[model samples]
Structure formats: structure tokens, C-alpha cells
Target: MIEYVARSGPPEAMNCPAFICDTCRNQVVAEGIVTWATTIGRDGDRGPHQQTPVYVAHKGRCGRGLELWIEQHYPAADGWIDLWDDLEDFVCQLTHNLTNAFADDTEGTYHPHRLVHPKERR
Candidate 1:
């Protein structure tokens, strides 16, 4: 995630054109895969919900396009790059009112997502 942000420079990720693919470290030019991950809250107090989306190419494979087709359906939880396709909504569900995104998604298909678009890039 940090790598993507550091490399990709951004105003925000939500509805943006694309994000970095963790596997290939390139821009996901169009629709890509989304998964989940698990992380221990920073303060060990459930961290007040998860943060940020990590991106990767779909099926362990890379993709190509004009790099301006898919508008981000969600925002990076903390504002940086995108790996989470639905990060904004996911974070909201989890942090808002102390709700949980797929039960904190700590278990099953966890990545806080396979949906961090699966893991934080770099």
C-alpha cells in the first residue's frame, strides 16, 4: 500500500481510474480482483476498523488497457493508493458505529481482505 502511494502519487483513490497491482506493481487499468486481509489493530484495541486498499492483478496475472477505463468503485480507507476496490464502503461498514466488514474479515478469505484488491503492494 505504502509502496503504491509512494510510487503512484495521488489526490485520492476512490472513483479514480486505477490502482497498482501488488503482483506486478503496475497500474490495474481496468476491473481487477478484490479480496480481503487480516490485521491486528495497531493499538490492539481493534484499531477502530481497518485502513486502506492494497492492489494486485487478477489471477496472479497482469492486465493492460488505456489505464483510464474503470473508475474506482471505492476509496482507499486512509487516502493513498488503491488496492481495495470497495475500500471506502468497507471501512465505513467496519469503522462506522463500530460495525464490522465481514466480521472484521480476520477469518475466511482474509487478506483485512483478498479484497485489498489481496495484499498491500510492496
Candidate 2:
């Protein structure tokens, strides 16, 4: 249901091999690419947090598709991060922890889209 697109700079240009997964006839329930960057804070910045942010997005397949995916995928108890932290850790977590979680059936199925608005009550 979920797949790894690629690892590269944002957008991956126009004709990159990463675009192979570009088309899905079944209609993507939800899909997005993860982009990471390292930025140096300005002199007046404030925080004890890391110097980067992780961003995850999901261009939902339809108006209600996103909600359906969340209901069927993500779980009630799982760690989450903001879209503004160094994505390195977030991507790594998804690649390893979340994927493993999916297999173990112990935690949520891990959806980049659900990460934004994790759950909704029926």
C-alpha cells in the first residue's frame, strides 16, 4: 500500500528515475515525498531543539480518501513529530521503526499524511 519513492533533493527534478512511481492507476489513497534539509539558525534564534525540521505531506487522493486511510492505517499510541524538525531523524524513523511497526502489528501503520492530522473520531 505504501512505497518508498526515493532519496534526493526536493522534487527530484522533472525526469528523474525516482519518478518511476509517479503514476498509480488504482488512485493513490495518499502519497507524498519526504524532503530534508539542514539550516543554520540566525544569531537571534531561540531554542534548545535541533537545527532542522522534518516535513511530511500527503496530497490526498480525494476529499474523504485521506480520512479513510487514517482510520484504516494509523494507531492510537505512537510517537509523532512536527513537519519542521530536521527530517533526517524522521525519515530514518519511518524507514526503520514505522516499517518494522507495520510488520509487527504493534503500532500504527505509519502514514506521512496521518502524521499531520493523526486521527479523527467517528
Among these predictions, the greatest lDDT belongs to 1
1-122, model 1: which lDDT tens digit per residue?
22324333466444433456655666654356544333334335433344334334543334222111112323334332323434345435546747545556665543232233323443
What is the Å distance of residue 92 in model 2 from its true position? 0.8
TM-score of each model, paired residue for residue: 0.26, 0.21
Pick out the ten consecutive residues of candidate 1 with the lowest summed lDDT.
63-72
Model 2: which ten-residue window has the lowest total lDDT? 16-25
> Tens digits of per-residue lDDT for model 2 on 1-116?
23344456776634322211122323232245333222123254342322212223334343234333333433223222112322244457666864565657655542222113
Can you give the lDDT of residue 29 in candidate 2? 29
What is candidate 1's TM-score against the reference?
A: 0.26
What root-mean-square deviation over C-alphas does model 1 reach?
13.6
lDDT of each: 0.39, 0.33
- Per-residue error for 50 in candidate 1, Å, reads 7.0
